[model samples]
Target: MKDLTILCGVEACAIFQNSFPEQPTIWPSVGEANRIIEKFRSLPEFERVKRMINQETFTEQRLKKMEAMLKTQQKDNRHKEFTQVIIQRLDGSSAILPLKTDDDCVELDNVINQFIKDIDRKMEILQNEGSSSNPAPQVS
Candidate 1:
């Protein structure tokens, strides 16, 4: 059996998204992405940030770790499902458990923010002229 050491983060997301056809005819719309992010931000798990509007749960340290983890995974469909889970969690879907406590909320919020940053970074890298490697296997 394989291990799933990394928590939900940007690298995991990149792995999943990288599998998309080089030129996807149907990419997620900006509105959808924003909605996903917005929903993630509001999930109960992010209470740390909610506790203090000025505090930064999305710290640089965690972001870097998330980035590192994201880089290790292979592209897969899990990214879409992960995004959907976040969206559902935020959209008042009672079928799932809400972020339990302040710490959980804050931690998740930080991770989600980091995931966004990772995606943006990947986009930037993709836009720039660069060398490439053979893609890895899809995780899911």
Candidate 2:
């Protein structure tokens, strides 16, 4: 499989793992990711999670949003590091690993934290781009 990065949150991860138990979906916010970690910590043992990498799992728009967020993250310095990333296997099992450094997380793991930072940044950009404080008269 190619490099597939899902932009999802911790809570959404838990919900998706618990609810779907078949399809894998990435959450697009830090809040959701935190929730998933918390859920797992509360659990008695680690749960195996499965994630399917395909069009059915993610929308084109969402993917584009992730790309945009990535770009935004690259430019911003506020959020440049992440502690961990959750890796889900094809069989529906998952593990959370700490991100020690760029060397520690190779490719996908390196981007996980930046992706989280970009989610909100992308949303903020989208929102600002869509809204206008004052409605101007049409020149046409």
Candidate 3:
């Protein structure tokens, strides 16, 4: 397996986190980051940063992790089809909600997949920009 830490140092990764705080992308946890850093320690520092967010390396792992989380939260709905409704009342307002159906679950799954794809697209842009082996010359 290719080590991702080789793509970016901890400081550079930190800068990326700070630079995009609100972005929906998943930031690797500290332990994960540390492991990646250790694994790729042999690579040059700049090369590591360039490959920091390699999709081919992390995408499947991340998807599986996300799937596990979703599984833990999943409800067993073996019963016959039904609609779950929630009602709410306020001083001057009322609202109602229904439980998700099979279609809803499928739609949500598609959305999650698409969301991952979007994150990959963003990471690709960052990776390409970072991959330059030479630093641009500084202006006087």
Candidate 4:
């Protein structure tokens, strides 16, 4: 019993049966108990139990603490305001457009629209060339 307490936490004997019903909860030696604990730690149920403990620990007080921390971070970021638009091309090249004003955003939108139009025109040209090369069969 004392060895079980040393290997596991306190009250090892009391909660052992309920905690691990399938496996033998009471081990004769501390080393054996430690091996069993290690074996159980590898199990998925161990991870699920850890997650449940974590979820249980996240009380309202912890949430308030997190909210306060977030508010402080937001206050810190209020002074520095900038927007970045990332455009990733098919050629594995990327462009980052930094926008500080409404006019800059509008310009970016126009550029994107123009680029789309250019791509559409190129696709149309390719489609027309393909159709011309392979004409439809005549129904004689």
Sliding window of 10 residues with minimal summed lDDT for model 3? 78-87
Whichever of 2 and 4 has more TM-score, that candidate is: 4
For residue 64, model 3's alpha carbon misses the true position, in angstroms, by 41
Candidate 3, which segments miss by more than 4 Å at Cα? Answer: 1-99, 133-140
Candidates 1 and 4, the one with greater lDDT: 4
Name the candidate that leads on lDDT.
4
Greater TM-score among 1 and 2 belongs to 1
Tens digit of per-residue lDDT, candidate 4, span 1-140: 67777877743322255654485456555676677667656769867476344554778669899999998886444322211233343345564445677866765666667668988999999999999999999999
Q: What's the lDDT of the predicted structure labeled candidate 2? A: 0.54
User: What's the lDDT of the predicted structure labeled candidate 4?
Assistant: 0.62
- For 1-140, candidate 1 gives per-residue lDDT tens digits of 01232443321111124575674332245465566566667768666355343325557657788887776452223444445667787788754534566755665566578678988999989866343454556798
The better-scoring model by lDDT among 3 and 4 is: 4
Give the alpha-carbon lDDT of every model. Answer: 0.55, 0.54, 0.55, 0.62
TM-score of each: 0.27, 0.21, 0.26, 0.34
Model 1 — TM-score against the truth?
0.27
Clashing pairs in 4: none
Task: Give stretches of model 4 more than 4 Å off.
Answer: 1-95
How many residue-pair clashes does candidate 1 contain? Answer: 8
Which 10-residue window of candidate 4 scores lowest in summed lDDT? 78-87
lDDT string for model 2 (113-139, tens) is 556788889999887877775466789
